[model samples]
Target: MRTLAYSLDVRFKPLFEVMGSLHAYICRKSHKKLDLSPSWAQQVQQRITPELSDLLDGIGIDGDWKLTYLLVHLCPGEDAADFVEWLKGMAAGDLYELMSPYSNLFPAHMGDFRDRTVRLFQQWNEQYMQHVDPEIIERLHVEAMKRKQALPASDPFAFVDETTNGLQFAPMNELKQIILMPQYHFQPINVVSYFGKVTLCHYAARIYLGDEDFLTPHEYRMIRSVAEKSRLKILKYLRQGPRSFIEIVRHMELSKGITHDHISKLRNAGLLTAHFEGETLTAYSLRTGALEQIHSKIMGYIEQGMA
Candidate 1:
């Protein structure tokens, strides 16, 4: 029922995908839990040189993932290559100034921050991004445009919430913009980034290139998600109320990685809702609407396809 004060800007900038590709590579190195297939992981491992591997660590990818927010706010246009070129002539002080309000970007560390970001992105652009297929970027743009057209002007926030699976945040009077970007690298999960008064929500876009041997229904994905014992247990725990991830970990007495994996799958299946303040996850709750429709969804799928 909550609505934004106004219709916010919903953009489909390719710059997000550019950064997402880099972030995805870093996740492969640090988290080792990417939803991407084993083949994708193996390909990344094969493509990475020792220098790129070391650079991923050296850039502190595992720390805060907000290093690219500066570009989000200040980039002159939507082109990724142009943004990088613009960043080349940017002074360290200017970079620090722009990034400081959103993060604790210090003047003392500005030079290294700028240099490392430039080097990291430059290497990534040459090694991988330049050869990216145009079709992938086109897919993201097409999805975003559809969502934008389908947006209900009265409750714009709902579109964001639905697109992001479960990312929710209270409306802010000071908020100026909300960006609904699409990313393919982090399939089946959402990435929400905060920059000053702007909120960037990056939802997953599945790459369906020539692999659509058959159609899979959302109901089927939801069924498969809860078919496992661990996921069902996680859902049961959330039945009571929303719980922070740490709280869920303690209550379930499971390792952090396993807990995260379960939550990610549940989120992807649209069975769970995640709330956030800034970039930090506040809590997670079950999407009772989806649960309530289990029978209807199953019957609908059967009637349409089987019956």
Candidate 2:
């Protein structure tokens, strides 16, 4: 058997968090209110400066919208100057090619989208750098460093398991490198992007800036996944060993759609792993280290006051 080779690079980037925070602010209303604790959301909202508020309001869209994809491609470095330089260097055609996926939301004229997005990003960076507390950045950096140091000695896949709260997995092939970026506002949320030979995994850090409890996106899903009686039964069944779809459905006594939804939630949460034997047969088993990972996270939060 040929072994696969890959590398892991982890670091803190202020601009990455800035982009995520901007996205969160612009789409604040679209988020399920219950996803974030009411007090925490309100506290973050209160901290938004009047100028920043107006900036977001002015650029905001009416329905569900997100500019993160466009912003991420334009991100050049960890500073405002780097972003400006990157934007300035890009040709109009290149910008159009990048923004094409989201073109429906933008003007038919590519230049208009490029110019407007660049300006919004510039303003967003300025307001973020001015108002965001320095302490939050420092805390996130510390957490990133801890994860970077702790990950190298463990299984590469384990890094994704823990960092994403079991939501994602390491690629089985053609994965050259993994870059980890930690974010505050985007906690409990993991965003993955592929560029060239590397995979960018942006995940929520275990940093609490003194307002409300923070849960990794995976943790939130796990908690919610087992909240119902049916889902709990699914877990109990899977805990015993691998089972086929028919076995699960029959045991749970639920419709295929409902059982599938529950299984998907568990799988996404990293609690269950699916093995496809063939086109018609799939087996589900509890991920071996899943519970331990959650236990470690909870303990880390309690003992270290961070995730």
| Model 2 TM-score, all chains together | 0.64
User: What value does the lDDT take at residue 92 in candidate 2?
Assistant: 71
* TM-score per candidate: 0.82, 0.64
Q: RMSD for all candidates, in order, please.
A: 3.3, 6.8
The numbered model that scores best in TM-score is 1
Task: Write one digit per residue (lDDT tens) for candidate 2, span 36-84.
Answer: 4545445655765676566567765422224344456446577655776
Model 2 alpha-carbon miss at residue 271, Å = 4.2
Index of the highest-lDDT prediction:
1
